[model samples]
Target: MSDSDLYATHTVENQPQVLLPYNLWSADRMLVHAVQQNHSDLPTSTLTDFGNIAGDQLMNAGELANKNKPHFQPFDRYGRRIDNVEFHPAYHELMGEAMTAQVHAYSWKNESTTGSHVIRAALLFMHSQADAGTTCPLTMTHAGVAALRNAPDLPRYWADKVISGEYDPRSIPASQKRGITLGMGMTEKQGGSDVRRNTTRADIQADGSYRITGHKFFFSAPMCDAHLILAQSTKGLSCFLLPRILEDGSLNHVRIQRLKDKLGDWSNASSEVEFQGATAHLVGEEGRGVPVIIDMVSLTRLDCMIGSTSLMRQALVQALHHTQHREAFGAKLIEQPLMKNVLADLTLEVAASLALTMRVARAVDLAKANQHEAHLSRIATAIGKYWICKRTPAFVNEAQECLGGIGYVEENILPRLYRQAPLNSIWEGSANVQCLDVLRALRKEPEAINALFVELQKAVGKNSAYDKHIENLKAAFDEQETLEIRSRLLVEQMALALQGALLLNADDKDMAEAFCLARLGKQQGLVFGTLPASVPFDEIIQRGKLEN
Candidate 1:
């Protein structure tokens, strides 16, 4: 046979099409509407600009960062222990974009506004779609501001650095820079989430600074200028600010042991560190470290929720884009009835996540303003974190499968998304941690439970399916013994109930009906593509598309 004659079938180019110009905010009607209803004060112009950045330059840099994972340089050429974790230029470029977009410091920049939490959450959600790692530094910085204000004298110098929108990546003192970043050093080798079990001890010096002499197994954002760490002081566990560079412009005694070898989040560096009497400043009142750090944890957990939501959205968008382009069995994959059901089902998940998360963000804004929404957020945050993050991996995996074998390859973002999916649930807090927190919320702040119910009750007559879900949730709540033993089940129930409430309250009755029917009414199987034939596959699929 001639060279070109025998392999003619291979010559047909079966290229998978790329998804572009996907304005992360505008693409999701659910997200935009939620922002409008909750944070109307946020300038529409700002959101539009962010949407453009996320879909364009930042989106492109995301792929570049992951493609060139961070590498650790343990020592300098002169054999000094520098322990620098070097990233590609794209990583720094993304960092600059995030800072310029003001996602890292926006809430702090406009803390007095009603849109403080809402805009920050929006920027966070959109940016995480582009780059997951750099967001951690921004998160730490945002959380650090709250912790810093707790200091008796207030560390104005350091706190001001974080709030500044100038994105300086240099390793130097805050005094010499236009802006800076913050990291966290909480977890140690002894305990993961149990910061109280941390053995790092802080000794007070004559100048009122501290000498921290312990190790942090997971020191976030190694490039940051300072870290907020929990260490045992004279009174008890206290919050301390550990600066990388001291006032004298000398490198602090803290030693970066090594960079973590992790499954995902390649763009940012996490390190195991040792503090050899490194100088630090006490942040909050001595021994009130947990509450002070808890302030930070609260916001960080919200960031984690948004992180997972963005991952799921990106994965679904890619799957939707690919299936719309690729053909199989003499038709485009997206046109197949079964595929429509699957895509529509995934759409509901993404929409519900956005709705529920934004609602919680609105509550955060209210809480800051001394509104009753604080009571609701106390409980909702835990439930949202647990259920949403847990739901993410399965959604991402199935969405990846929608693209067939191409989804498994390293070149595509799907594989990276698959790797990053579980990081949110595991980081900040794990499944059991979040579940236990939910259980704690149910017991301690019963008012929060009441608020959740009140929110759900608004949709009582909207849909029979949703009404049934609310009733089932109440019934489950009454069974305290069962709830205690199976907190995950109870928490999951609470989350779905809230989502149902949001959807039913939403103007889009069709999507709401489909979600309630698939998740609450029908006895669907434990997989995607299980939407009942009674559901409007065409309407749901059309509404789900991120592309116009």
Candidate 2:
């Protein structure tokens, strides 16, 4: 009593405990429904297990990894040029579990499955909530398979190891390891997004290989077994696979100049490296680098959408959990009117984000067998990538506001999520790049536009606002000269229309109405908590809450 009254006067009160171990799959009603609606064949037990681990141990590891950022070890005891990046054990723990669960190989390994991409997308969506940094290599490793396909022999030797779901962090030749990861190097200092402006050179050698000499401004995941890099060859820009360690058990000529001090993604390592006559093998024909790398880039862009959506889901859950337990002036925060409105608005965002991204995943899955789906995947990916990523920073910030001061603190997860939100938008390509890609697709591939409209047309008679939005979107496309200047506006409308149509087709009419009212109708506002007063705020908030 003496100690409690003397120094413990400011005891912690009116605060919620850290969110405990919960099943991310079962807790997310919308995700579960989306999986069912998409007709995914992946067993529920798999997701249930990953969801539990992601919510508990993986989340804890994320904190520790971020707190102790990766250390760059460029030399050994004898001052040898090691050029290695070492991470905290927590980072490795997260990677091990993620790889063990087949987060990087599910879609590729289960190519015969109907909804393979959808199932894998769901895994990534949930796993990223635990820690997004490690997913960088996972994404690169997954997407790199696409680019490697251009060289059939490369896949003959690498595909098995890639789809093995074995996590090998050792800096050794791919042949010597149980499994291996692949990364990419594209952007140079002179041109961030313009691959044509790159100055790196690749010279063909007598052994049919090439010697690459230049610097990559952004060499992602330098610790990976190999990286697909673009360099200027005698013919033109070409793609090459540069390994970190040669098969002879010696370090390659690739030198890690330094690691970038990025804003977030602390658990990952991105470096700047110079190729001092690095031995490499071309992936595709010279002068066709853009097309080869574009395949890999498209897959990465899909992951960008997934990562942002995951961040939004995590932020929303954190806000909802905090509000339910924390008290304000006289009542719990969740019971407050304004707070309920904010949560309901975020609920709509998460719902729409998941719907659009999962739908895109299905399109990607079906594209291999259907032409319409292939066109839709090509065009819709750009639209969703541009809009969903553009909306995440604001979404996370509004969720943070529900917790007041605590949300901004480093000890809480919201701060980390906030820092991770912007990376997705800038990673594969910025907003403008995505917008331009949409325009390019529309111009070069008219069938893509037709496919997108056909998909949007399914919800034509469902809602008046949605129908009108579709009409306006179609009319917006008529002005060819203004499309470039108004690309963002056009892409945004496309994204909203796509999300609105998907929601209208969903079983939850109330969620669909709320999304259309807040996003498609005239009642929308610039910030969160602006849904019409007539909407069922408490019902929506209740639907969005996690059971645990």
Per-residue lDDT for 39-59 in model 1, tens only? Answer: 766677777788888888888
Q: For each candidate in the order shown, give its overall lDDT on alpha carbons.
A: 0.85, 0.90
C-alpha displacement of 34 in model 1, angstroms? 3.0
lDDT of 2 by residue, 1-548 (tens): 68768776577778799878788898888788777778646578888999888888998998999999999999999999999899999998998898888899888988898988888998998889989998999999999888888877564657678888889898778887888888889999999999899999999999888999999999998898899999999999999988889989899999999999999999999999999999998898888999999888878989999999999999999998899999988999999898888999999898998999999999998998899999999999999999999999999999889999989999889999999999998989999999999989988999999999999999998988898899899999889989999999999999999999999998788899988887898686789998899888988887788875
Query: Residue 328 of candidate 1: its Cα lDDT?
Result: 88
- Model 1 CA deviation exceeding 4 Å by range: 1-10
User: Which stretches of candidate 2 lie above 4 Å from their native place?
Assistant: 1-7
> Which pairs clash in the backbone of model 2?
none
> Number of clashes in every candidate structure?
0, 0
